[model samples]
Target: MEFRCKKAGDECYGVKELTLLSEISQRLIQTKELKNDLSVILELLVRHLDAERSFLTIFNRQNSKIYIEAAYGYSSAQQARGKYDLGEGIIGRVIELARPIVVDKISESNLFLNRTQQELKSKDGKDLTFVCVPIIEESQVTGALGLLRLYNPYITKDENLYLLSVIGSLISRVVSSKQEQMEELEALRQKNQELQSKLDDGQRPVNIVGNSGKMRDVYSLVNMVAETNSTVLIRGESGIGKELIADAIHYSSKRARNNFVKVNCSALPDSLIESELFGHEKGAFTGADSRRKGRFELADGGTIFLDEIGDIPLSTQVKILRILQQREFERLGGTETIKVDVRIVAATNRNLEEAIEKGEFREDLFYRINVFPLYIPSLRERRDDIPLLVDHFIEKFNKRNGTSVKRITTSALNMLMIYSWPGNIRELENCIERACILTTDDVIHSYNLPPSLQTADSSNTQARGGLMYTVEQVEKQLIREALTSTKGNIAKAAELLSVTERMLGTRVKKYEIEAWRFKV
Candidate 1:
């Protein structure tokens, strides 16, 4: 077959060139695997050109070197040996110069370095011609395409060079496209790995309890803000695990390896609050003690937890505001302005909003620290977690006191659950520890509880019986109140009563109460 060539400008008629170009284009379009398509294209070029061998070399931009990607008429071991630095051999020189090279006889050219050690002699004992053309993309050479063939008297060097350059252009496009696709996929994979690593870090064990929905929301907030250096304000009643949440935030953050300094703002006196937070120079006060680094300086590159943030004096609040805004502060008596990279996480049981309204707290300081607010629920709000907390305390006291207490009895648990935990987890823990010390048997009975709990239980029992109503009547009254609060929705009423929908339905049936009458 013969074909006319417009781009070549030769009006050429050659069967070998037409067949090689057609087969390469067809295979490239049909094949999905780039490596396999390149191998087949190289084999076909070697056969059609009547060359002893052919190979394609790709440049590694990262290493600034070229290596054989595919080859024909060479063993797999020989193909693996063709690695060249830029301008190191015949192929490298073509790529480095961004041009084509044709050695009429391999032995005559000094550029034929013979890096691959492949056979270069023809069957008739005549010298062979080596041709190499740079693969140019957007005017820059990306790689080299080369072949070795016997010297042909009929085929001029210009013709062979022109045909190879056309093929080099085609190969350059395919290789560049493939490289771009691989790079995009690799980048996506790395991004997914980083996200998964962050998730794993967030889920890592922290010494906190409870798995209620409210606590789960807290966990999500902590995970969301742990990667940033933002200020976090933890708001809740005292003994509601605000400090535990602060610990979780710091330990799960990027600065986990650094210090986590803590200071109780309410515990320090007004005279010493500023010096305690911003450090003090020698002989700054009447004590004239040695220079000491404050919480902010000690917590550089990490986090600082300021408990009871609302109780700091007004004068100290201004200094705190300056540190939050400028990230720089000076010692109590020093002139040097020290800068720090500390992450601030403050917790307070007092209502800062009310304090701000009363002009007792700085509004600017409150806004600065409240960039991320996490509110921990009180024990009364998450009542379902009480049993878990009881078990945790029991196990803890069992280990600490060397006592073999297995569990609390049903009566004791019921009493513990009904009494409002006014002091929250901290108070509950102390109560359990005292009970464990007082109990004689492995199981803690109701009588073994603290006198205050026993007295409260007795008062509750007397009030339940002295009302001159039967147990059924009292149950009916409670169910009515729950239905009223829930607007007669059985599901919500049951949730309010801490019972299942079916159980609430049975009680309504026993009392002969009309549930819909309560809805307005």
Candidate 2:
């Protein structure tokens, strides 16, 4: 280490402390015990630089506490405790603002709490300067370091601040790794909580099913978008599973525990859509007997799925745009602007661009939500998924109808494959529900096909011949093809199939396929 003195007024380098501080940094990587590692590093940096006192605080978000995990040079009484609140003093301010701050004059900085000023004075009144540095994790401020000093002629606050930043980086990696591990454990805990809840409820009410290329695209998009705050637009014809995709998006997000609200934009009358979306004060108008929170207000810190948005009235489009743009909105007949952190996931079968051109939709609103567009292909487009979807709907309806139907007849599945699903997945659902209601046997046979789906014998033969198998048979064939295409690589097969890895695994088990033999 070299030698020099820092001027009292200088806001810059303490040249004398540079070499020793650099050396302190080099030793940080070799230390293993996190607490000891940080303590040793900060202790060396402060001591070698002749600082009077130093401390490190680790943010505890769960309890809103910041424990003083490390400290040196303070009196035995002052350094005994290892904790403080988030904004209790200048130290907390560093974490709050995520910036470095220096208080050359104690009374002037205004960062001092009564206790903090008293504690600093106890350490040494000779040095009037102090510096605090923020520690960050995942681009977020997590904790801070506070350095105090006596009237040391050898060191300065600016040098200490720089050292703190460099040291904070090393400590942050350790803290962040611990934080991430804790988060993963917390996630597993939460997932277990949800599972326990699902178990308590008997069975989950919602389940997704599909194994097709189009569906695989939807699955891939869902996983990719789940990690972001992107606004998704799901476009598909009516009867398609737009709501299903919307649910998948929410359940896979960081805000999974929060509410996932769905609004049918078209189902509401232009007369009441405003009140329904943004809520209203008591007596906003007729039937507004009591004040209510709107969907946007209710879905704060969560996700809101707007369905059939293409059908919302033009006047209400303005309100939707404001909320999407500003992330804030006021209820009907209310003056207070309520801000919400809502992840907007909108779905509509109508062509929004065409609607915009016709003045039925707002161009700005469309662009705002079109950030991450997710257009769903119709059931007809993903016919390979028919059997999986059929199986899904069949199981659901069987439980609902209290029937024991376990299989879809091969010929019936083929018939389903050939029919152009004008109504999409929704139509298929209704068809399966009807089939379940009418079936007197274990198998959902071709004869159980609804009249809307049934056609003349020769055309039926041609249609069945067109697919060359029953709907059920085609479904099995598609599943087999998907598995083979991936060379029995179940995860890829699942992606090729459009179901979750779990769902694909289940099917693979049910079909007795040795999926493990395949290469990933």
Candidate 3:
């Protein structure tokens, strides 16, 4: 850490500082990835400044809040805690004033908020110095960059302020470029949604049954991209109807008349996947007996859905990327390249971005298939749609099972509503089907549902009382149903409920039932 004295007129860096600036500029130019590169830049700043910590904060105008975008030497928890509103703290004040602030010693300054709860002292007995400068872009304050270092009597605060201000200018360019890119993408998405809204005019997907806000958004995205040949990536948890989304897109598209092929990547072994997707020449492998066309070839001029795409092997990902890019791939063990026009619709429950970071998934393939991404909301997220989904599944199951079960009772519906559908719509359908089979009468009851839905966390019925109380409530409900079916005839109602008239009379008196109201 050596430097020449400040020039008499101009604020210029010394040789070492100039070299550091050059290195930072080269690194920023080398990578257009804002988040990843900003982190590298921050590390360089902390190391060059010999500082304890450094942070790059961004002010989101939409929310009117400032948060740390990147940090050096700070835990993720600490970074999350480092948030401020306008005029709230040092970082906020720097952006608010659009000027740099240099505190000689953090321990002596009342303005230092210490929001991240970091120690304000060096390993030695010295207090820490703090410097923050606003990052201005296009004559507007966008964010601030801050640095913390051990205080030294020999170094002047003005020098620290100047260094940070220079670094902030470099950062301003990167953040501004990133913000512009995001704004462009958001604008395009908004335009597509508007067009979709006008075209659909509140029309739901013909096969899908949901009118919730989140599902409507999904519908809009589906309608927006369905007519195009763009590759679609559907993301959601397992059984969240990702495949249904794929179906809506493919069936609504211009290629609806063509073959729609589906490949479940997770279901096939790694060795068989290549052959399954790209086909194989005769005798290509130990099991290859004859020439077979692959899903891509079979789906020529149509859409091919690759479900659980995150499980695809890395070796096969390259061929998938090539197909997405050039619409061509050679069959396994064959040199001749085959060309096919196939639109891809990939679905994955796994976090593909996390997989890329862990070196398990290919980033190139991700970007290729992410042209039109659609995120299906989880069942718990759209609980308002549960009843409609329930009715749909009930009608479906009733038709399949040849039962005349009508509707679910209010108690049963309440249990379904309160329980979190962890397995999402698929789990809900399974539950409804089982209940329909067990239901003796036309109406489904709470007791007809599975035992899992009866837990305290799911339905909160235990809050009223324990197991005995729950049983008593169900007993009362059954007795009331029997009385209603008998049209208030106590003897017949007692017989229907399989209880003695004396016992049934005592229970009716205990529950205070108005049996005359049900008389025909």
Clashing pairs in 1: none
Put down candidate 2 lDDT per residue, 274-308, tens digits, no spaces.
99899999988988889999999999999999999
Off by over 4 Å in 3: 1-202, 456-520
- Preferred candidate (TM-score higher): 1 or 3: 1
Query: Best candidate, lDDT-wise?
Result: 3
- Give per-residue CA lDDT, model 3, range 1-520, as digits (tens): 7544443113333655787799888988887788888888888887766678898888766435577888998999779777676787788788888988988899888998787878888877688888899988989888888888877666777887887788888879787765565556656765675666555545567889886668878888898899999999999999988888888999999999999999999999998999999999998988788999899999999999999999999999999999988999999988889999999999999999999999999998999988988889988677657878988998998889998889998789777766667788998999999999999997889999998888746533343445665566557667766886887766578768786655687788886665654455
Error of 2 at 101 (Å): 91
The CA lDDT of each predicted structure is 0.80, 0.72, 0.82
- Listed in order, each prediction's TM-score against the native is 0.52, 0.50, 0.51
What's the CA error at residue 377 for candidate 2, in Å?
Answer: 1.3
Candidate 3 or 2, higher TM-score: 3
Best by TM-score: 1
State the TM-score for model 2: 0.50
